[model samples]
Target: MNDHSTNKPIDESWVAHLRDLSTGVEPPTSANPHAMSRVAIRRTRTRRAVLTTGGGVLTVAAVAGAAFAIGSPTTSGPLLPGAPTSASADPSMSAEERRAREVEAAAVRALESGNVPAGWHVNVLEGLVYALPPEIVTSGPVQDEPGVTSDMWHSSEDPDSPPFLRMAYVTPDYEFYDTKASGLTQTPGPDARSFDLPGASVATVDDSAPLSEIAGAPEADPDRGLVKILVHREDGPGRYMITMNLGTADPEFVEGFLTTLTLS
Candidate 1:
């Protein structure tokens, strides 16, 4: 009988025969069948672990990039249009300062408009512009000494009114004298005080003696109260002396008018 009944074909049995020949042992059978399956399972697990680790590393790198971008300091951008900056940004101003600004602005607006009140006239002379009240009549320049030019305003109603307004422009050669240096004694009253005027230095004299005395006038009206203002010019070499006799009206009204004077 042939041994072919128990033998397998060579094509299917050669792998086991080769394995046994290499190892010098008989090939394994059904007793150890899962050896190849365990190797395949370990390979699959290792590949999955590598892919998961790579994905985690990529996620960490992306997060770090985003954090750096967010935490970096940046330069400031331009301000919005029409935004107030510098000195104007400060809003705290005293009431007196605010009033002064408002008055100055109003005077500017008035000068731009060029509209004087009815029956009132605006005199522009000696590098200045000021308004005269309706009740005062402007006479021609008073006959005064050399180097001194003056415009006199008298009350329209009273021929011999003691109260009047006098504005004088003095030349550089004319001696500049003030109450502080006149050596004339002042009657006990409100002391001399300085005031705020745009582009001018102004002082108020409320002494008992008439302003004419301090201004070296030949005549002094003791019965007339005077509101004398010494205005230091901002643009030129001369000063303006404004005197308003209180016989015209209230002293407060005269003060208000003096405050309205603006430099040309």
Candidate 2:
């Protein structure tokens, strides 16, 4: 009987075969101490790719900025809506005075225009009247008069906006009316109607109460964009904003315009 547990005579030929296999396996020598060099190379390549992509993005942004600057209008001779086309138009004022007048005229192009400028653009001067107090609205620098108000064109310019040309007028107290807003007034005609500004208060409005006003809010939806329609009364004179609608006609360009507001 063959004994399974007891040690059998060793096969010297098989042992020789195993030793040959072991000899075929190469071991790391002093020449190549670090075993995992492939991983490091891959990491280096990834870092280089990321840096290259970042540089390309910055280059594109710079190019776009340059293009915008170049395409916009530029003139050193005279400002629009002020300087006449002919050299002999107004030879009385000095160049400095002419420049100052040009700037000032450009700043108030609408009132200076006396009529809305042509071809720039126009949004609806939709007629909407509302009640306000005399103490809550004013027009100089901020709040001057409220209630009997008219369309005020104080907004960021856009081609699709309403009433590109705007004018504001003060409405009188004691009665509500409806009509076209040629200028701010409470004289309501068949076309005009009152507006609703929810929960507006007197401290912020700064004008007298029970006053009437009119303004234009374009047809675009303000809530969708971060852009909002701003209408409020402030304490300052000559500059109170009655209403503002902000947005982009382009879906991609929609954004808010004003940076600050004050009631006093």
Estimate the TM-score of every prediction: 0.46, 0.22
Cα lDDT tens digits for candidate 2, 1-264: 986777889999999999999999998767543545777788999999998899889887787787567653233455578654754445566887866665454434432433332223322111212222121222224343445344444333444543222234333331322333333332223342333333222112211212223223332433322121323333212222233322223222211111111111
Q: lDDT per residue, candidate 1, 22-75, as tens digits?
A: 887657666454888898899999999998999889987787787567653232
Task: Show pairs that collide, candidate 1.
Answer: none
Scored by CA lDDT, what does every candidate get?
Answer: 0.62, 0.37
Whole-structure CA lDDT of model 2: 0.37
Q: What TM value does model 2 have?
A: 0.22
Tell me, by lDDT, which candidate is best. 1
